[model samples]
Target: MRPYWCVAVAAGVLLVSACGAAGSGAAGSGGPVKLAFVYATSSQNPFQEMAFGAKAAAADIGGVDLALSAPTGINGPQEVTQFLSTIHNSKDGVALETLTPDLFVRPLNQAADLNVPVVAVDTAPPAGTKVGLFIGNSNTELGKALGEEFVKQVPADATGEVVLGNDIPGLGLLQQRLDGMRSVIKAKRPGLTISGPFDSGSEPTSNFNNWNDIVKAHANAIAYLGVGAQDAVSLALIQKNTGRKFLAGSCDPDTSALQAVKDGYVFALASPEHWLKGYVALRLLAERAKSGKALPTGWWNTGSLVVNSANIDQIIARQHDEGSRKAAFKAETDRQLANPSGYLRPLAEAN
Candidate 1:
């Protein structure tokens, strides 16, 4: 995902002018609790699946009304507006996919004032902000996992160019993933000459065009690493057409990424358990709403894994099996509730 900035919250009186809070309402005595979820961007495949899990949880676990909302695109200001509007109307608890942490802290604190539980998903409260619960992955670890894959696939004494790509320059989100890849590569295979961690947009043409130019220039590049799903898929297509034998490492696995992995074009893709993310996050918020509990403090690493020829087929098959997926999710959710500390740990604990 392409992110804009990770703005830090100022240490002062929490401002309220920007985040709208004209009037707030709550459930009546012995009444159904109303809950909500807001995303920064529209329901892409991954996020759409997340909303599905949340709604399914609401159906199974009753006494709560689930309302989901989000802006069409990456409109940070509009997302804040929608979030405020959502919380204003539906009052109880909320799980939000925070685009800009700075824009959210004020309103989130406002929700806290109402005694409404707020859980952060996709992104989290910056350091020192007293947000009790955060649910997401250690993307840096995911990057490192992919780097390990690169070292395993590429020879130790290999000498060639490495073409890497990213969408935005200063996006705090992608930057972490990029940094993770760079750190791993530098540590494991310092002999490789990495080139063009270039600007790659989401559109297929842009990815293809940018990588096409880079691959043409550096025909000796041994492998290609991309920050997002599109980057690796585009390279996969290019490699197929050109019949080049470069190793490809991708960040996420969309259908194309999976197909590339199934074929020989892409070697490996690192992933944060996205399905687990949605189901577990919703379970956390729902537990907060039904019971008077809050999410645990510190980062909840969803865990990361590498997918290659050995596991891609099984993984792709599981993605289609909703029954099995939900069952696994339920088991994980039950385990988390039984012992959240066991399921998650501090960021410092991860490799």
Candidate 2:
């Protein structure tokens, strides 16, 4: 029916198609497994970085199509809504940052009923959610680390003020961090006077204003625990207003915050290995999906590292030259993965 040349070309195309289908069949011997990563908000750089890392890691693994999405805002209810939508849309597996576990538990269970592996990253879901795994640092341990670093920097005899700037008042993770720091401070240094566990509010501008007012009122304060990006803005404001420096610590890192660490404006930053968190979450989901096994229960604390002035220069240089904070993240990830049992423990167990 066709010319000789055309017939030969058609035969070749058919052969190639057959071989490709066979290869795909061998690769996905179990079933089709899709992965979706949903974040609290696309606007925050931290969540965006996590999404990027997850997508990149998924690319490394065969038979994975990573769909990274996020809500428009940081509201917990909105996060829950986005997560539920993602679960409904996902055909295979899903990974999400758990801002409000209570809100998402029932929906997550419904996904689990459909045999979709669900992993929580960045924040732990509510207890008894049957979540596959939690891949992030112990928030309380991070808080304690910040407190210890602050105490180390402040003068022992100085009975100065210390303030903790918390962005989310009701969040369990934030409360755990504050408690961890407060407990350590109470145990180690009874002389240090702690001030208002001031609510920094969610918005950056609100945090900036709150910190500005706090710094003005308590000029003698020696330390602050900033829980979010506004921490950097607060540090900048402090430098502008007081003309004096105090030990500044934060739960996470930002470009400006890292720069502050380099400039000696920030005393310490507890940088979590979020890249590894994303990678592990995806890898675990992929493995579980392939094996037809239920996802592992309990939390997997990925871990965090404290970066200070002594090592800030190297961190900054790595950030500037190599890539988007991947080097530091890789180092931390390697360390934790190498000794998972040693470092990856619950907050209560960490102490």
Candidate 3:
């Protein structure tokens, strides 16, 4: 068994490290390489899926001790504190999701000063941050795909409103999703008017209520699209409760959202491949730690999934449990290792 110390902090942080070894030299001596994968928040679906992938990577690539954590809620300062503390402790390497890039400038630059390999996941790093690479879905493309699904479901000549809700109005990723969907709808269905990318709070109950209000107000909308994880299930719930026929689409394939797609309530789901991002981020760090390989510089597009009636069953089967999900993506991970250039792209072209 790998000798290590795993500490669980009350601040919702989990830090793991190999005992009695300098992280930089650990891999050289075949000792455990410690890593920290921190997300935006704890107990959320997307982040939990990411954690699953990170754990799988740590296990599959022996001698890797991975620690993961995030804030209990949407607290930027708390997340920053976790990031800074992890940076100070995790000497092998660190990977993180910087939703609010501003909060990470100091810690990211500090990591750079310490010669630690840093990879940003789920969000691209800001201009001044010292992130080696980014790994996540192309948010704009995901939105365009969701919009295409909406367009396919609507009538050819239908001219009506398409209501959109954003759980976090100012978030760059959500805004990009809204913009992408808007671009698609305008190009294909100019006759269809787009409504507000309203601030539907990220909290589940409020998210549902906000969508409920939007639907009740625009009962005749051609389609309702959500740019947040909660949007899929909320819109589906609203549709099922009121028997509304408005075509509904949203992002992420959470359990309820997948069921929504399978039940014919939601038109389609845009899956950002949360697990792949986590797995790839941790795997990259492990490779660098063990083999002295340089982490690729640029955006590594983990890609996305458009879950609909056609392939919902396969998606559902893979997500049944952590083991099933890891097993499902093993070949893809191998493919990534076999050809890195295929997925890695310049930072500017990440969109």
Candidate 4:
């Protein structure tokens, strides 16, 4: 989350390679379909996984040109600027993760004015925008799941405290998780106190400092809910530093975070099947562009999967052997698209 040069370096290399490899695949019939992708944290594992998945999906289709980019940290204005720049330079379609919905509308509208389709992946933009599709899990649902999981782990008759760490409160997706967890915990466990939906910043070091403060103040806190990798890493680091283990869980799957879970430092992690999301986004865009039809306007909610010790082996194996995380995403996308009524739903109706 820190302003690291690594992501820019990797992105530059990938961009060059992608541009160079352009002639190998068949370009779309009307013209080359240029798709731009923007994410939250370029260095974090989940964002990297999502990018890999997007690349794989683009490769599988073999007709579209996909360009992926992300800013170094959680600066909303900076990300919005990137989105606008992509829109200005884009020739076909655009897909982005909007950290702040309000900040995204203008650029999204600009894309719409140019007759370019826009899609939201990983996070949704503000309502009533011209966004054609959304391909990510409901953050609120993940949050409720987190609260329910925590309730199951805590002693029923005793009062306990759970800390929800927010890496960036401005991101609407993270807020949904916080809200969902609050709703479920308040309903099911009245005695449970949820404290400090604190802004941990987007950097890992900032998150560590914020978490250290929480742990110092509330030594008896039973669990930690992290909305992003920074919070997840903070919990892991805190356990290592204090030699005290708390029930720590997170909302996304990053290689480092998953490794922590495998090592027993993390209790659970939940994330939308991102590989599938990427694939679906690409497929849907292709369908719309090919058919010369405008995509639906409302949000599309792609549900998530809960990963624990039981299924960690399968996930790790899939990541290692089959393809990049993106390949797995393509397969999952195929499965879900096969039964749209069963697996896909409108965001308004999904919640």
The lDDT for every candidate, in the order shown, is: 0.68, 0.66, 0.83, 0.69
Question: How many residue pairs clash in each candidate at the backbone level?
Answer: 0, 0, 0, 3
Per-residue lDDT of model 4, residues 130-162, tens digit only = 775677777889888877766777766658888
Whole-model lDDT, model 4: 0.69
Task: Extract clashing residue pairs from model 2.
Answer: none
lDDT by residue (tens digit), candidate 1, 135-245: 777777777788888888877777778877886556566677877888888887888888877776655677789888877877777887887757778888888888777
Residue pairs whose backbone atoms clash in candidate 1: none
> What is the TM-score (0 to 1) of candidate 2?
0.82
Kindly report which residue stretches of model 1 are placed more than 4 angstroms away from their true locations once superposed: 1-31, 127-129, 203-209, 321-324, 346-351
Pairs that clash in candidate 3: none
Name the candidate, 2 or 4, with the larger TM-score value.
4
TM-scores of the models, in the given order? Answer: 0.82, 0.82, 0.93, 0.85
lDDT of 2 by residue, 115-157 (tens): 6678888877665567746777777887788878877875667
Q: What ordering of candidates by lDDT runs from best to worst?
A: 3, 4, 1, 2
lDDT of 1 at 304: 63
- What's model 4's TM-score? 0.85
Choose the strongest candidate by TM-score.
3
lDDT score for candidate 2 against the true structure: 0.66
